[model samples]
Target: MHRDLHAVTFDCWGTLIYEPKREQGALARREIFRKCLQQHGVEVTEERASDALREVWLRHWREWQAGISSDATDMAGWGLEAFGIHERAAVERLGCELAEASLEQEVRALDGARETLEQLARREIRRALICDTGYSPGRVVRQLLQREGLLEFLEVLIFSNEAGVPKPNPRIFQAALDPLGVGPEQALHVGDLRRSDIAGAHGMGMRSVRIRWQNDDTSDLPDAHAVVDSHAQLRELLHLDGS
Candidate 1:
């Protein structure tokens, strides 16, 4: 159980916020392919390109996950086989292909992140963001937080791409805490991913809370100090009233 929380750190995607689209299985492949081709001066319709991209993505998805290791780069070694595109320049161009996807304006605050943050801001607890890297850079992540009005309340926002280390590797977690001037035990991390956020936090002696919205698996979450269904519960975890 959590005794007291000095700071509340969070994961970005699928936790506090989400990509706009619902991640259509084949459609993701098609979108990637369409962008890859466009980057190479090839013009193709979305429908035609997606058919091939779907097959490529399917193959890569199976391969990538089948042999995934604790230290493997999440997106490495799947580019050429999965999308028939491996050029670094092309990959950069395809990064924002799904940029249009984001939570609707109404549900932008995942399960009470806004409310929880507001409550925490009034209390003594500090707040920070330790998020995984996606197609966008850390600046974009900060922009999203700002758009949601979360930036003003946070002490730091650590992104893997910016820090050059992924989570579950104590360094990234340390980077988040470095700016706060607090030790591990004083911080409480909240995220949806068990492997990266929860496990990583516990590894470093910080408390952890697992958010179960997209991830329903509780089998591997024994180390988490608490389980919250939404970001709103973050306030309660910090022992704050609605205020």
Candidate 2:
């Protein structure tokens, strides 16, 4: 599908990488969350961490889904405050200051991701990152990417904070395409969200691939140009192995 595409832009957090706060095994993230919660006099147990993380994320996700658009700057601050890190000391103790450095470690590329992307990039197909922002500022994100050695493989990086427009909006998609000097039809966007990536890229007239890494039932298949269950499947779908 869309083999003539000049570029393949991806959603960073989920499509090219796995960042599930509600999922377990994020030891570093657990430490960060625990530190933040404790500063506000809230205690998190091994049993309660999952519920708490999900509850907080669900509330924020609902706000966004309900079309309550807010600036990444303010929204992130609101999230922290709502999560009970209201005190100045709490914010400091929560490693907010070390957040930039911490993010470098957190931006782990998905398994088998690097070799695939390296092959894809070497083909002269431009690689771009189109991602949500708010949790970490754009500058910090850039730094993290650089630190993680991902920048060398990416041709362009677009963040909600930098674009001043959130996803599911055509403008954000356009912003990513504009700098690449390519029309929407010449590009393919891969993302994990039905509403945001599929609808948004579709609005911009770009081909879209939905990654089913989370196994969500709402496949967005009717609207998606393609659906991939794994990176291996994605490579096959792209005919990257000479299939």
Candidate 3:
């Protein structure tokens, strides 16, 4: 049951990086939305802005579960609509600001993430990222990766916002594989979510490894082919430890 892995794909939010200040980022975004609304002469309380942001996130979650992708712009529009703010300029500014809000807060890569990716790169094993981005889009996530020195190690970056489809959808997986010229059988996807990452890669005929170093997803979905708690274990599993 040993298959050659030519390329390795990864999930962003939980597998590689942990958003320790996620709430702070959310609050920043909420404040950005509130100020944007005020500039448009549509005043709303912080509580109401927070509620709109929460509703938009809930909608995004629902869409993601159904394999649909919603980007920052989409969420921005939804947020404006929630408060009956139809100003085109406000939507544009809000989207731009909200997309960049996460940059204000720091994001940390899980232990061994950078080392694992660097080792994979040294071995010429192609790497790609298949991220299901939330309010922050692929551009922001790429910046975060670059800050952690992990972005250069990846060859292809496929974000659901850009692909128009999220993980658990075969198309997203194919999008990552097509650029690498690596088939599903020759690739291994590592992620934390059982529903999206595990199910998506498995359904695409790729081997999957679940990493629970950050968030341990206990969803009632199919389990991955292999499960590791950290990238050190992942290296051992992938025979990268000189075993």
Candidate 4:
């Protein structure tokens, strides 16, 4: 155990919990968009809706790579414009429905995640989450985390959509670290992505551990200080197993 460790921050999607039915969630969101467009008296096939959704996702990816973030509302507006339907009410409704669609899918916490957090809490090490939001914004993510019983352990939750910036950017990391009253060197960050999570935490002068149970990112970016395949290994690495 690192005697100087004061806090630990996590990346939500692949680190703590994962959407087990991601493809199903995507299909559901596409169907929801189709129905929303139909309600606006605009006829669109599922193929067209899928294309629009794909485009919006691509746009989001490009923006994310450039250190910009967009939320479900922005996605909704872009999607509506793609279908040539820009009714204000329709955009709002579609945004809301899209945001809530993930709730219909199964989201499960990684193995040993709760136990790790509980141990950390017991040891008085603060916890926080710095997640990059996609279709689901910060508010939706909070509901998912709460449902998984992980929210109570996290004192600070910083979503890219709410922060107006994504990981690999120093500001987002600071957003979590500042409120927790911990500096970069005193905290550790665990996440899946090398480009975003690992790089971001290191950039802030914090130790980073890359968890690969959910996603094994193969990017050429610098590797984290340590890599673990599961939260079980993470517990061992952090010396939370009471060795």
Best candidate (score: TM-score): 4
Per-residue accuracy of model 2 over 1-243 as CA lDDT, tens digit each: 746878888887667665445233335545666666675687778556555545555665776676444333343244456565666555544435434434535456665566557778768777888887644656777776666567788888888767766688787778778888899989998888888888888888899988877644385345588888877788888877551
Off by over 4 Å in 3: 1-3
Candidates in order have lDDT scores of 0.65, 0.68, 0.88, 0.92
- Runs of candidate 4 with Cα error greater than 4 angstroms are none
In candidate 1, the residue pairs with backbone N, CA or C atoms under 3 Å apart (3 or more residues apart, or in different chains) clash, namely: 20-101, 20-102, 111-232, 112-232
TM-score (all chains, Cα) for each model: 0.75, 0.73, 0.95, 0.97
Poorest stretch of ten by lDDT in candidate 3: 1-10
Q: What is the lDDT of residue 9 in candidate 3?
A: 95
Lowest lDDT block of 10, candidate 4: 82-91
- Evaluate model 4: give its lDDT: 0.92
Collision count of model 2: 0
Which lDDT tens digits does candidate 3 get at residues 86-183? 77777777888988888888899889999889888878889999999887899999999999888989899999989989989999999999999989
Error of 3 at 9 (Å): 0.6
Better model by TM-score, 2 or 3? 3
Per-residue lDDT tens digits for candidate 4, residues 52-87, read: 899999998999999999888889999988767887
> Which residue pairs come into collision in candidate 2?
none
lDDT of 3 at 150: 88
Stretches of candidate 1 off by over 4 Å are: 1-4, 24-32, 35-91, 96-107, 219-221
lDDT of 1 by residue, 1-243 (tens): 446567778887777776444455236545655666666677777766755544544653454234222111223224433545567655544544433222222225565677777777788677788876643447666777788777788888887667776677788889889888889989888888777788889999998888887665556545577888866565566667645
